[model samples]
Target: MAEPTISVIIPAYNAAAFIAEALLSVLNQTSPADEVIVVNDGSTDNTRQVAASFEPHFGGRLIIIDQANAGVAAARNAAYRRASGELVAMLDADDYYLPAFLATARRAFTLMPDIVLFFGDTEIVDANGPTGRLNSEGKPVRTLPAIEIDGLFKVRGSTFTTLLEGSYIPVCAAAVRRATALAVGLFDLSVRTSEDRDFFCRLALRGPMAFSREVMAHERIHGGNISISTHRVDLARNVLTVMRKLRRPEHACLMSDQERSALEAVYKDEFFNYVYNLSSAGWRAYVKGVAMLPADERLAALHPKHLARALAAAVGMSSND
Candidate 1:
């Protein structure tokens, strides 16, 4: 009877097509997890059958729980709620970890005992596999922060504000201390999108985070991509929601004086960045962005002048209109 060191959590929903691959990734880890917890998230597909089939092999280390259909956020919440590990690594049903992911994390904890969380770069995969290892712009995917900590890298600016612009730490590829995840209240059940960004944002406020350039997981970009499939319209809106949530009265003390100030200033750029991008999607999406934008930002996005500018941006004309 020894304590479990880490639990690999796979939140599956209608992932029978890919759950087996995801499970094998965990089972084949260079440094295996102490236990594997899969929450069947009420998938109508044979995800349960596919997941449960591995039980006999796990030899009591596999725990599969079933519940009525809840979103991925809720499924993940349920796993951690019942998990008995000190640390948890998240793996989406469509995405899986590299063999060395656990080994790298174990080495990191041994070297940097103070870090509460650590994440690494991810190799992007498409329906066929490894999209030639390039980002959307056809450039090699590389981790790019200016500072080095131990063997990892971090942003030159405030990590919280840096994260505000968008998500850099791939939650699927990250490993976090269970206590820290619980202390931050896990993922917000209320938000249907950007919940991952929101959860990590809260974690960033709690302590230093390690960003290892080493590729730890493969992010599959099939048509079922969660954000695009589930909440494409809410992309900008959810980010804005997370920014506002982090600034709530209860979490005020979690931020430092500098982080607090940065939140205010960064909100402006983040607001413009997300909204303006939406504006290019068309006036309809632009209008949706306007509705989700903060009150002050709403006024700016709805202005007649900004409307003209949005039209120009949407049609490939000069936004100086």
Candidate 2:
């Protein structure tokens, strides 16, 4: 049999309510994936059942793996190992892709044979309604344009620094060459929130990435999402830890000074944001951010605005305490 052109990996927990839609989206793709692998990560709900129901529809095209609740990173890694496609794409169980996703990716890869990664714009939807399509910053970005190789780092200023700010590249909207994904190593299992950011940083350092202007997926923002709930503190902590690890590595030298300065600004913004955004025990979160900041002189480079914000937040917390 011919090798599949793309493998779509979906890591599902208790996503019964939305997994069906996610599966249907892949099955309906204009340039359908060669294989769809859904890993049911010890879901207590009917997630397995929902995945099983689609078995007949996908036939040999769908492969399901059941494992104990080992986290999304582990589930994705397992699926990646089982995939036989030349390219690997990921979609969260709660999200679904547009029909043109794979078709555009195929064309992009054909045109830019050297590019190792491809990602496009996404439509952000919530329980209330469709909010509209957005770029990585949650800003409305219309028009799809092919980005030049240097444009990725040039526009972003610093790739690593931009990553420290936040995840602009939504994992669900990304497709990567199989070899490139494997070479970069699978997503960091230790990071619960910023695994995609860590993976993207590593990949960007290795090769060029393609950003498609097309909106090819819908990212659902529900109450149950990790980003929406109170775990924002945990997310902040994990992202800081990942950033610290990246900075200490020899690869950190690959980034320009401008990128490094941008990263410092991101660290300060993240620290201040966590301090002000905490609904419960603001002092505790502030303490956590302070504890996470690097000890070196680099901390002195934090933006004055962020420093002021952090100070204001600290005073507010102290008064409440």
Candidate 3:
């Protein structure tokens, strides 16, 4: 069977220094992408020039879309709108795919015909150079039983629960069926941080997903990453928003009774964590956190002592209290 065409979407913002390496990575893919779409999201740098420079080299397969400074989510949505392929893959301007990345994703798709999303391990890169694999807490990326398709091996499973706990799949290391993406919709523009998590969570809810054991991409860790620049309170708020979205009645159809119960437990834990983080901010933030809590458990789990402490902090109480 002929391999399905894959379109790669890259949202770049003042990424002139690193965009070329990212484009090169796609160009060097063992199984070339059907098209490479680079959306220059109101870049102040020469990102447009750098991206356009590669169009001729790729025989016009490289497509560049220039949009006013809207934000990463908008930029990605723009590129996604123009993508024409069976599968849509994502890579950040500062990140690049390993040579075998596309091949591995295709293999996973072929073997797990029922799945819509595929992701693999990622190697973290920094100024010092290639560092190590991305992990959760201190645990390395988890392994699962393997299945072979054609000549490649991939593990099949549902990452919905894992994704709800925390995002382990980096955008650069994952691919989704174009149909699945359209069904799931675009990234949430309101979420400046953890937008990828929001997008992945929605996709995970839609259907099954799988993973490749091999490291298929590079995730660059730098000061420019949105997660690094966004305020902790705002980040926590966005996370809470995603958690709420997952628990909505419309999304509840995605999981069984047991899984839904498990998710509720997770949400309970996350609620406390959110409130604790906002406790020191002041009364307004603390109230906002409380307002964001799920109706089912709002204030039920919030101890009066914790509320008093939050109020005390809001009114200039010492940390000792």
Candidate 4:
């Protein structure tokens, strides 16, 4: 069996300052990418110039797809359409991969014929340096790696089940087979945010996924990070919406009854979290979220106290009352 060819697809938007580092990481990969595609989604900065500059260095291995101010999902879709490799390595403009990332993923695909996707842990950083490594719980800590192994990748337990619990798989740390990507239809553009979550959820339904313990990629955390800049309320709301759609009968049918029950439990957990986050914002968001809740699930999912708090927040009264 031959190792799969990999394409590193980066979607950049006003990422001039960081694009070079990302490109360099790809260039320095132990098992270098077979193709490098960067889609400049209408960046006003030098992102286009900086990314396009790599074409010559790649010696025609680089592809620059310039498009209007489309979102990251669309930009990735464009790059994927142009990618010819058997595996697509999803890299973010603000993040860079460890030298072993592609080599590790390719080796996994070559070894495990059933695995279609895999993600590794990410090292969280800031302007200073490394802060901590992201854990399975979507948190950061300066702890040791999740697992110690001489090998590049580790085939894990139920990827789908773990993913159903939370959205911990960072975009920068994952790679998927090109065929599997097409089968599920890459990214969902309708979502304003959490498109990565949507895409990953769909992929989880497809088949098995692997995990890399230590740090496989770098995730930069700054004030200007997308999760910070984007509207949190809207993003959180869309997250629930997307999750509901993803867990519908068509997709949820693949899961056993226990899995489906677990899926519903998480959905409710997310719903309450969403409402709690909006409690301070006032009634409009609360009303919207409640309205979005289905009639069947409302009585069980939405507590009276939650509604009372929303009403209380709308008025001058304290929420405790």
Candidate 5:
């Protein structure tokens, strides 16, 4: 069999309700993926069965690998090892891609062969309504200009700083060259969350990344999502782990005073937010972060916007009481 131009890897765990839609979205792509590998990470539900249903439709083009219960990072790494394509794309089992995702990615890669990674805007949908927007903070939400290598460094720090502060790019909306991903050593399985952020930061250090204006991915926000249900303590711990990793020698030269300050502020906010979410010992973590901040900048983290949100949350809690 010939190698495919693009390999889509979907890591699924107990995603029976949405895995079928996710697979269909890929199969319906105008420029269908040459290979689609779905990694079943010891799902307790019918995730494997749902993935198997697509094999008859996609035939040899679809591949399924069952593994012990591992985190998404480990699952993704396992899938990447098995993929044989120039371009590697990721689609979470619960997220569906737009029909134009692969076609747009192919065109973008062809136009800018030097780009190591490419990502598009994403739409957020929930049971209540559609957010109808991409994160406005990182990599401007409007139409992206054709950027070159020189342009990358000019905005890399600011863009990455914003993304690290909060997850701006949906995991399902990203695609990277296989070689670049391998060169970067794939995702880190040590951290439970923020693995994608760490992976992108490492990749950004290697080569230029292109952005597409169109929202080629749909992110479903549901009660079951880790982002929504996971305890803030766990989230904060993983975020801190990611931050500590960034301070290593490989990324040391890239860190500027402003970038470091931004990172510190983000940690402070996370600590406070964890407290607001009622996580145990969050206050202690917040105090520790505050103590670490430079005296002059400690107050900067208590910006009016954050203060207001914290106050609002307090009021809501009081009302519930």
Candidate 6:
């Protein structure tokens, strides 16, 4: 097997409907990936058949692995373990990359030899069409010392706090050195949701991150999105887990003061989500969250307001009151 300089790892579930487009996007890259590995996570659909169809076209460059019904984190880890490329790019089976993605990655690496991870801008599209740039609750992504080339803003490093504000880097839009990913221990398998937050935070700690302002990836928003399909309460709980994980002693030093503030803000947002989003149900989840989180003045200060809102909501009192 010829060693691939860049290995694309794709974790597919029952994504037979879209895996072909995803694989074709990779194959059509302006700078092609040396290898593409697809981990089929026990998809009942014909996902394997679709992925295998491209093997001949890729001429031995496409590799497929079959695994039990593991979550995305486990599937990614499985593909990572089998990947032999110096650089690893992650793509979900349902999402596809733009032709310039690999070219931008290669150029970014050439510009900054020490770049640990390079992520491009993403455009969110549904069955309709392009919506706009991905908007998270956090501040927009901007470079510290930005240089514009071919309409792409090049940044030397992306602030950890900026990332902690929200999920700025979509997995499909990001690429990392194989060694950097392994050193950071790959994705956290125990986490079922918000795993990207945990992984990206840890990755940012290892070295500098580069940003390509151009939208080089397309994020498909469908009802089947795991983060969207899951109940909000469950999503809130998983986000809390990520928050607590970031607060661990070993990871604490990795956060700057601003990053800590951003994390706290995210905690408050979670508090609102789990505590006040659905009144009684939210109250129950919020109580569990309170028990889970360590006592902090920041959280304490926001409790009464959230509690009042939850109670008011329970009593059918509108905010107009």
- Among all candidates shown, the one with the greatest TM-score: 3
Candidate 6 clashes: the total is 0
lDDT tens digits, residue span 1-321, model 1: 332388899999999999999999998898888899999988999999999999887788999999999899999999998888888889999998889888777666556565677777788898788865622232221434445657765444346766665566777788888898999999998777789878877887777666677778888886754654225446665666677777787776878788888777766665665666676666667776678655766787776766876687668787753
Instruction: Please give the CA lDDT of all the candidate structures.
Output: 0.76, 0.74, 0.79, 0.78, 0.74, 0.77
Q: What is the Å distance of residue 27 in model 5 from its true position?
A: 0.8
> What tens digits encode model 3's per-residue C-alpha lDDT throughout 1-321?
677789999999999999999999999999989999999898998999999989888997988888899998898888888999888899999999999999888877877667778887788888987987463324323644446565444444545666677777778988998888888787888877778877887887777777766788888988564543126667777777777778888778878786688688877777766666677677777777677666765665367756776788778895554
* Cα lDDT tens digits for candidate 6, 59-115: 899999999998899999998889998889999998999999987887776666676
Task: Write the number of the candidate with greater TM-score, choosing between 1 and 3.
Answer: 3
Clashes of 1: 0
TM-scores, each model vs. reference: 0.81, 0.77, 0.88, 0.86, 0.74, 0.82
Q: What TM value does model 5 have?
A: 0.74
Candidate 6 has which clashing residue pairs, if any? Answer: none
Looking at candidate 2, the ten consecutive residues that score lowest on lDDT are 150-159
Instruction: For candidate 4, write residues 121-164 as lDDT tens digits.
Output: 88888898778746444332122132333554443434555565
Q: Give the lDDT of residue 278 in candidate 6.
A: 36
- How well does candidate 1 match the true structure in TM-score terms? 0.81
Lowest lDDT block of 10, candidate 3? 135-144
Candidate 2 local Cα displacement, residue 292, angstroms = 8.0
Residue range 195-229, candidate 5, lDDT tens digits? 88888877766666777666888888877645542
Which one is best on lDDT? 3
